[model samples]
Target: MKNIILLVFFVFHISLFGRNLINPLNKSKDKNFSNIGLYIDGGTFGIGYSTFFNIEKYLSSSKSEKIHLFFRGSYGDVRFLGSGSGGGSFFKNTQTIGASITMITGRGNHHFDSSTGLFYRDESILPLLDLGYRYQKLNGGIILKGKIGILGLGFGMGFSF
Candidate 1:
């Protein structure tokens, strides 16, 4: 998982600079905007919302891609599967808070994002990794994300604004 995450990051980093090398004159201007999204995860059967802020411009002007810092919060009632008749079934209300750094690649309305971060759950903080793709119109768009964290492996879809 760590290797895969590193590879994804490497690929996006290369893509970000590769575009600049290809055609410097054709490079687009920086887009700095905040996005808010709601998502549901299969790992914990949780629903969450997140806010992303594009902070690359403030940090540097040389880069052509956007880098975002995001905060997410989620809530869910997770059922313990396979408890059997003797053990019965149990459910827990779970909550999580996370922060991540995301790099955005591609152009126009369609973009790909690679993110890595950390989340707090069940009294412990754990690393979180995700690879996501989004399609945005003027203000908002749809987002699809696959992630691995303390909650395990999960996929989610939501609207981003």
Candidate 2:
């Protein structure tokens, strides 16, 4: 009786958990899902907001990994002071507009992505690079991201849908 019960339980366990172990690449229908979120970063004293878009699922092939594209716009103020007897204070407004492409790799909701791109600031164009990590819940939960780049380093939290 004990041997029969043990065999039955083993079969039942496999039948219950086997489906969850299937490879994601084997699923044709779920291979192309898109996700969007918002993020914020601060280099200077002012805060910056940007939108994040993931196009990897749509563009991925058997040999390619996930890739994402992002666009950002930010505004901040800078103050400068002169030296010596003729010292004076000056304040200026700063703005930046940029775009980037990132390659993402990891498992489940956690990912590490590295990106390189360009930004238009101070009437000229500048190069920007960032290596970041993010945790995004697929079934609707909290989203978090942190990055370090040429501009500076910052962290952001938001919701994923």
Candidate 3:
């Protein structure tokens, strides 16, 4: 079940953003860019494991903001960790796949997952929100980022070109 969802998301990304959406937007500045950065992250809470990462390129839209999109996939192994609701404890893992949109304005960022839900015991689709600040590297790409929400707080490093 997890594998199927991830595969579907990979196909969706290639068809929607990789082949069609971003190319047309980059036709003009095609010569000024090279490659996109890659990222990988994994961490664990008391009884839960979470990971988020993506690889993407930025399509120059205007001078002030950049239109950047990335295919991001996340999987979490969650357990009640301790006594909780109905039962003494519970455990389950969730898989999520979706795309993220970031603005190069340096102030903030946002992302939306078209299909995100849990697997195993409880199942539901819950949209996640990411609020963070990005810093552009002097050479190219992004250097640092920070975001916080129901997912918790995180500090990460990324490359953008």
Candidate 4:
């Protein structure tokens, strides 16, 4: 997983400068205009998966080239999957739903995900940070990309059109 994440992130950065990808929200602003993709985030503290559907919109006008705010949420996770009648078994599964904001640095993208919801009759809070490059295709269709952070890394091919 680590290797795959690295490879994808490398490719995204290379594509940024090489293709002059449109960042939409520059670094100066306190928010990112719009972004829609699959969120794969986790941390060393927990052994679970996070799937998110995000939508970010710009709040101000900035020319520094950065992403500030991006609306985010994690659908749920498959932590528990087992069943028995004779001798019931035990498993752990969870899900999270919350809000998040981001701030971009100089070279890479920086963002965070915080979600809290009930999963399997249990309450939980899941927070994560992601740092990587986001690429926007020139054709204005779907954007294939990846993200690497302190928690877990994600490599996904998505669309922005």
Cα-based RMSD of the predictions, in order? 11.6, 18.8, 6.0, 11.8
Best model number under TM-score: 3
Candidate 1 lDDT trough over 10 residues, lowest sum:
52-61
Question: What are the per-residue Cα lDDT tens digits for candidate 2 across 74-117?
Answer: 22221223211232323222344554555556556887867677
- Between prediction 2 and prediction 4, the one with superior TM-score is 2
Tens digit of lDDT per residue, candidate 3, span 21-115? 45444445434442454555344434554465655444344433244434344443333354223443343334444344444443233322121
- Steric clash pairs (candidate 1): none
- Compare candidates 1 and 2 on TM-score and give the better one: 2
**How well does each candidate superpose onto the true structure, as a TM-score?**
0.47, 0.54, 0.55, 0.45
Global Cα lDDT for candidate 4: 0.39
lDDT of 1 by residue, 57-139 (tens): 11122244443333343333223353222333342223344555555556566666555776544455667666656554323
Winner on lDDT between 1 and 3 is 3
C-alpha lDDT (0 to 100) for residue 114 of candidate 3:
25
Q: State model 1's lDDT.
A: 0.44
In order, what lDDT does every prediction score? 0.44, 0.46, 0.45, 0.39
Extract clashing residue pairs from model 3.
Answer: 141-160, 142-160
lDDT of 1 at 104: 55
